[model samples]
Target: MTLVGRTAAIGTLDEVLAECFAGVSRTVLIEGPAGCGKSVLVDTVVERAAAAGATVLCAVASPAEQDVPLGVIRQLVHGDPSLALPEDALAAPGVPSRVQDTQSFCAALREAGRAAPVVLCVDDVRFADDASLA
Candidate 1:
């Protein structure tokens, strides 16, 4: 559905985007039941990020059984090939593999943001595995 004329949440998102551009890490966790416009909020953030010259990476989880691990990372890496994986982090035994991957991906995204901001969007986080949540 189109989000035209949706001001209240979009205005708040604009404020959040301003903060992100001002060097604050934007980590907004939108929570509500279905049809509450959570995805719309995220889409607005992404649009703002893009307008501000920020790289955007987005992933959505499916309820189907064939989903893969680090699907978000795959999307981010696909969007920007310069995003690198840290070798040292992957070698650590204690780290959950996906966590290491995600962390390294985030680090790369943050570093890239130094040149131009980056926005990493992960949808259906409620379906993410506990290990991924850690």
Candidate 2:
């Protein structure tokens, strides 16, 4: 479907995309109430990034898994089983914790970015686990 009434969002995302392509670090957080086309808007951006030859990694948070630490990160990392985590990467504790896992995820993301322009997209972040979101 054609994206309608999202010229501003699209323009903003285009700027971020341009920065990413230019080897500049950037982050864009899109938030809105449910059924307000947030997902659609982000999906459009993802498509644009891919079409521009960037490697796009995406994770969609699930309400049922919100209590699972690193659940969202795990989804992104494991989206392609070939993506390897470092041997020194710390595992998530039995209890939900943020720092170690997020650090590992970020490191892995940095490594992936070395191969190509990496666009990390997290959808439904409002439903992401506290540790992951924090």
Q: Which candidate ranks first by lDDT, i.e. highest?
A: 2
lDDT of 2 by residue, 22-134 (tens): 88999788887779999999899889999998888889999998878767766776656445344333264346654655666677778778866888789988888776676
Alpha-carbon shift of residue 20 in model 1 (angstroms):
1.3
Candidate 2's TM-score reads 0.81
Write the residue-wise lDDT of candidate 1 on 49-114 in tens digits.
Answer: 798887777876555512444433444466455785555432443444556577777677778778
Model 2 poorest ten-residue lDDT run: 84-93
lDDT of 2 at 95: 62
* Count: clashes, candidate 1: 0
For all predicted structures, in order, the TM-scores are 0.73, 0.81
lDDT of each: 0.66, 0.77
Clashing pairs in 1: none
